[model samples]
Target: MENLNNNEYQKFADKKVPKPTYLKNVILAFLVGGAICTIAQGVTNFLESQGYNEDLCGMGTSIVMIFIGSLLTGLGVYDKIGKVGGAGAAVPITGFANSIVAPAMEFKREGFIFGVAAKMFIIAGPVLVYGIGSSIIAGLLSILFKG
Candidate 1:
């Protein structure tokens, strides 16, 4: 009877939950990333095919993507996509825009000062800092090289 109880305890304690494989996650990430890039490329191609200049096509593609992201965000759809796509959604510029807007939306209820205005840039602060810092460093290096 003691051995039976011991066996039952062991069985309960030794139960294991299976986890998704790393390779499966990696493959899903890759596919989602590729799909996003492909959509961006298609937008560019469509713009060019419609007689837009290359620069305009590029800008339009960016604008369209950001608009789509913002719209999805406003409609609460982008959050769902973000949850599923993870790094795939995050690595794109649209994701950067979403990051900025989403936080602002969330904090909007706390009043404009501490909530909307303050949090508007919260997600983008690091990105802006790094971007400006890199540009300054690059400009300084260019000036030094010229001298």
Candidate 2:
């Protein structure tokens, strides 16, 4: 009985196999990243074709993508995409928006003030703060250089 148990344990231990090739992972990452960029390019082209200014077109595209991401987050689809696409979906501006919206949605049950309103800017606050700070610093530098 002892020998039989040891054999059984050995068989179970031997059944554990190593994972597949690194090339497969690389290919999948490449495909997902390409798909994300393709989608962004398509949206940008569509926006430009609609006669929007370059800045407006860019902003519109970002807004639309973020909104779509947020919606997907609400519908629990964004997480699925993240799982499949990994860094592909998580590296974009849309992902930033999703990050902001996700926490707010999750905390929505706590009450509007503490939950929705407060959490809405949790992810975006630092970006906004740094954006303004950097702009101000750049403007000061420009003025100093010009003067």
Q: Give the best candidate by TM-score.
A: 1
Candidate 1 lDDT over residue span 4-91, tens digit each: 7887777776776465567866776687677878899999999999999999999999998888888888889887877777778877
Off by over 4 Å in 2: 1-30
- True-vs-predicted CA distance for residue 2, candidate 1, Å: 33
Q: lDDT of model 2 at residue 118? A: 89
lDDT of each: 0.85, 0.81
Q: What is the TM-score of each candidate against the true structure?
A: 0.77, 0.69
TM-score of 1: 0.77
TM-score of 2: 0.69
lDDT of 1 at 127: 91
